[model samples]
Structures are given as structure tokens and as C-alpha cells.
Target: MNTRILIILALIIAGIAGWFFQQQGKISPPVNIEASEVDYEATDIKAVQTNEQGETEYELNAESLTHNPVTNQDEMSGITMNWEPSDEQRYRIEAGSAAINQQTGELHLSGGFTLVSEDKVSENKTAATDIEPIQVTGQTLKGNTKSRQVYSNEPVKVVQGMNRFEASSMKANLETGEYEFGKVAVTFTPVERQNKALF
Candidate 1:
């Protein structure tokens, strides 16, 4: 009887030890992830232009512009854009530190940039038509002396007439007076439309 009891106790202990080992095998160790770093640089840039209008044209300056040949990416530092004032809404012009694609001749402006419009209209004694802040990244841009078009894989905001629109992408044909946006979101303020009859 003593021998049989000892044998049973040994079997029970062995079973408990096996169960603990199985549970330990089921557990997985934590994984470690490492962070990555990116490196880049920029330098002094300047641009000047003369407009036919009598209004004084402004100059643009920047600290630096850079392009990564390995990634085909470009960047600009401390960019500035300026324009000449004119009574006639003649043309759309942009000047800034930009990265030009060697293959396609596409230009990309980066860092601090400003866009100014010559067209200004007064409505209800308020200066209503004004250029809004814009940030553009694109594959190419094509336009003429009178109009401009910017094509990109990102969104663009445009205000025309009394409506403002945002879209994922766009093709603006300024010559034909046509602009189309893909997956567009538009908003119109009621206050602007109220004065439409007066004009």
C-alpha cells in the first residue's frame, strides 16, 4: 500500500510539471522595433522679375533649396514669392525657390511661399476677392501668358465667383474657362451670395 501511494504521488507531480511546461511554451516573447532617421539640406536662393505694369514688382529670396537624387525628392528652405501690382487682371505669376524635375521640367515650390493676385473686386464696400493661402505639390504644371494650370496628386483649394472648392486633384484649363476637380468638396458662404443681385 505504501509503495502504491508513492507511485501515484509521483505520477501526479509529473503531470503538473508537464502542464506548466506546456503553458510556458504557448507564450511568445515581445518584439523590438527600431526607429529610422532622414537627412537633408538647403541654401541661399533669389529671384527677380519685371512686369509691364507701372506697379512695382517685388523680389523673392530663400536660404536654400535641395533635391535628393536617391529618392527623387526636392525641398526648399526659406522660400518667398512676390508680384507686381496692376490695375488690369492680366496674368497669374508665381516665383519662388523651386525644385525642377530634370526629366519632365516640372517645378515644385517649398518652404515659405506666397501667391498674389492682381484681380481685386469690392462688394458691399468690402474687399471681397482676395487670394487665399495655398500649398501645392505636383508632378507637372502647364499654362500660358494669360492663365495657369497646376496638376498634382494632392488636394487644391480654389475660390471663384462666390464659391470655394476643395478637391483631391484637379486639371485647371484657364484658357477655356474650365476647371475640373476629382472627388470635390465645395462650400459657399451665404453672405457672399446675398450681394449677388447688387452686382
Candidate 2:
């Protein structure tokens, strides 16, 4: 997880639904939020939430959803979250399973996670060589909607352009677009120069 690559991921994942929770505020449990009825569990769910400016901010889709009263959390499996914090940037995240604290809006995802897509323009966008799409994977992660940050203590692997990186841990500050990685290993591939015709 190089600093540059890490920043790319952080910016994409940060600001992801932060305003969603801020607007919803604390979700108080009703009747302790036990999944006592069939309605508490649903399949193929899609949710769209707008921001204060009446602009669409995020969309969440899940294969199945359930409320866990014992933990007071909303549990979702096979989830895909898409966030568009601004018109210029968009990110798509996929998780095997996730739990959102009903009261605090804290989110924890586990059982493997991937950043499916990100459309943030980087400085290398205008480089002679095109910037390739990157892929990121982690076993578990935690995110705070309040701080707009994501953290992972598990191993993180990223493939950016022609570079590959791995780290023992990762922390991304979306606000500042900074990434901190622990004990990182990285490899870069050099591309051969292409000849162009000058008329």
C-alpha cells in the first residue's frame, strides 16, 4: 500500500455515506429491534438516500438483510454500496457481510471485501501511459461515518496500474486524502516506451 495508491483508495472510500448517517442521526431501536417478524428479514433490497441539497448521495443493495436484536445492529450479506459524494468522484464497494450499529452508524465489514470500482481522477491521468484501474482486497474493515475514514488491521493487497502492493494494516483519511500503511511491500512494472508518428 504505497502512499499514492493508498490515497486513491481512501478518497474513494471516504465520504462514502458519511452524510447519510449524519442526516439520519442516531437510529433509536424500536422494541429493542428484534427480528421477530418476517418483515425484519428481506431479500434483494435496494435503498437510495439523498443529501441535504436534494442530490442523490448513495445507493445500497443487499442480497439479504436482517436485524439482530441481540447486537442491536443491522446485518446485511452480499452487499454492494455505491457512493457519489461529488459529481466528479464515484466509488463502488462490495462486501460479503456487514453490520451497521443502529445507534452510532458505525460500520464493520468482514468475510472478505473488495473495492469494486473508483472513478477518481489522479495526477497520472494525463501521463503518457494510461492509468489502469486498480483492485483492492481485505479480509475485514471498519468505517466511521462521522469521521469519513476507513481502517483495517488485516492484511491489505492492492494492484494499482502496473504496481502491486501489500501491507499488514491500512488507515485512510478521506478528508485529507492521506493513507498510512504498516510494513508495506511493493513492486512496480516498467512499461516499454511507445513510438509515435510526428506529422
User: How close to the true structure is residue 27 of candidate 1, measured as C-alpha lDDT?
Assistant: 42
lDDT of 1 by residue, 146-167 (tens): 2334454566565554456677
TM-score of each: 0.38, 0.64
Q: What lDDT does candidate 1 reach at residue 61?
A: 60
Residue 2, candidate 2: alpha-carbon lDDT: 90
lDDT of 1 at 8: 97
RMSD of 2: 28.3
> Backbone collision count in every prediction?
3, 0
Candidate 1 has its poorest 10 consecutive residues by lDDT at 139-148
| Highest-scoring model, lDDT | 2
